[model samples]
Target: MGSRTILSSGTKTEQVFGYSRAVRAGDFIFVSGTTAMGPDGPVGEADIVAQSAECLRRIEEALAHFGAGLNTVVRTRVFVTDIDQWRRVGEAHSARFAEILPTTTIVGISALFDPRLLVEIEADAVLTTG
Candidate 1:
């Protein structure tokens, strides 16, 4: 089986703890947990909704790097620092994958790597090829 790594410009392997943001093995693309951090830095200080959107955007970009897109996502996992923000976060997520409607799970966590980080997301997708 052939394998490949995907990384956006300025995105480091160490950022994801020594792992590539996304790895492609055959037709499957496995994306690691993606935070709101952008190429310059994190987005949205304490806005869970904005942060959630940013996280999904980054994940989508990672998937695209591997010839995949949000529509190809098969499953997803989301983590939020506060349970009360579920509605806001969920709304943001839904807007991103509304068409794909991939299987998803959301969990409330005590905290994340950074206090300002309100959400994190991970996904699995399949690239379509003829």
Candidate 2:
């Protein structure tokens, strides 16, 4: 089957590292690990909660480009630099996916590509065939 690339003017995607921000194969949209980095710059320099929200927000935007939304997400993976912020991160995540509640996994990580990054999230979604 053929695949499609999803991109938006609101964001800058990275592919030089041998990966895409998101790829659409048929009706499935696979999103790569999204950090809190925005078009302007990274968010929540020291706040994990805000960072987590930003990551999810970026993922939502990527999904939306492909006619998909957070509600269409079937799976999500979260990586955090600190485990102590799990509660706060979970709250932020729940607020975003409260209605859909996609299967999710959270892990405590030592660090990320950027030391300022407190959280990263990746998602998999199924777009409506309409």
Winning model by lDDT: 2
> What TM-score, computed on C-alpha atoms, does each candidate reach?
0.86, 0.86
Per-residue lDDT tens digits for candidate 2, residues 2-116, read: 6777653433345436567788887889988988875455787788888888888889898888888898998999998888888999999999988988899999999987788
Q: Candidate 2, after superposition: displacement of residue 1 in Å? A: 5.0
lDDT of 1 by residue, 11-122 (tens): 5545656667778887888888888875555697678888888888888888878777899998999998898888999899889888889899999999887677888999
Name model 1 segments beyond 4 Å from true. Answer: 6-16, 38-41
Q: Where's the lowest-lDDT run of ten residues in candidate 2?
A: 7-16
Per-residue error for 76 in candidate 2, Å, reads 0.5
lDDT for 118 in candidate 2 is 85
